[model samples]
Target chain A: GAGVSQSPSNKVTEKGKDVELRCDPISGHTALYWYRQSLGQGLEFLIYFQGNSAPDKSGLPSDRFSAERTGGSVSTLTIQRTQQEDSAVYLCASSRDMSSGANVLTFGAGSRLTVL
Target chain B: AQSVTQPDIHITVSEGASLELRCNYSYGATPYLFWYVQSPGQGLQLLLKYFSGDTLVQGIKGFEAEFKRSQSSFNLRKPSVHWSDAAEYFCAAWRSNTGKLIFGQGTTLQVKP
Candidate 1:
């Protein structure tokens, strides 16, 4: 793909239901990240995957939030038993490589989640 | 931990006016700085970035940013503002070893025509 792609641009689900968001990073990008943006707020780091290394999940708000990247390609972010506060725009970004010591991220349009 | 701060939550300026948006960062070492713009319902677009170079860095759309190491600031500037420039602006920083970004609360710009 020419750029990072995210699926389900808009999602609405019950408060207790689980939802999944997907991200397809730019081809050849070795680093991927997930972020959450609440209304009128800054982006909050959720998770990061670098090659085959252990993912950095330091930013996941709770145990209910989990994400995985398969085969070093597409990634999925799953929020179990979503809460109203969980309603936000989930953004995915990727960088060409980490070797440069400069990470310039290209982002997707994001998946907007609404919990009712 | 690396963090970015954008002081102004919202700002309004007349068209053709000079514009400046302030961003500050907190990190143990000098960190990479960036500015991004986001239109409504759109993804973030990099406006400019500062790695290791001259203090002033230029970017697309006639935008530029200055990295002031003494103040731990990276302030974005434009000689003249355009109506199309009205959007949400974000300031972010990342450590050299990692790809994760710590974003500041965005500043909303409203261009009054």
Candidate 2:
């Protein structure tokens, strides 16, 4: 694709259920990022993956939140036993290697998750 | 700890009016600073970024931001704002070692005719 892509543009799930959101980053981008944005709120960094190095899970809000990238191309963010507080628009973005200064990122439309 | 701050929660500017959106950051070492704008039902688009060199950076749609290292601020500005410019604006800073991009609460810009 010409731009970053995210699946399940809108997802509604029960409070206790589990859901998975997917992201397909632009070709050749080495840096991928996940962020959560609640209504009227700013983006909250969730995680970052760069190349084959260790992924940064420091921003995950809790143990139930996890993510993994496959083949350094696609990624998935999973939330288990989701809570109402977990409802937010999950955004995915990709950028060239950080070594490339400024680290400008291209963003996806985002997947909106709703917990009921 | 590093943090990005956008003090204004909401701002309103009439069409053709000049505008300036404030952004500030606190970090130990120099970091990458960025401005992103999110339109309703749309994703965030990068407005501009400052890593080093020139303090004044020009961005798309006639938007520009000046990085004031002394004040720890990178404020977005425009000579004249259009109605289409109304959107949610976010300021963020990325720390190289941690690869963490911290964002502010954001400011909602309302354009009135």
Kept native contacts, as fractions per model, are: 0.94, 0.86
**B1-113 per-residue lDDT for model 1 (tens digits):** 56899999999999999999999999998888999999987899999999997999999999999999999999999999999999999999998665578999999999999
Using Cα atoms, each model's DockQ against the true complex is 0.86, 0.81
lDDT of 2: 0.91
Worst 10 residues of 2 chain B by lDDT: B93-102
Spell out the clash pairs found in candidate 2.
none
Per-residue CA lDDT of candidate 2, range A1-116, in tens? 79999999999999999999999999999899999999878888999899745367888999999999989899999999999999999999998877766688899999999999
Among incorrect, acceptable, medium and high, the docking class of model 1 is: high
What lDDT tens digits, residue by residue, belong to model 1 across residues A15-92?
999999999999999889999999978999998988745457889999999999888889999999999999999999
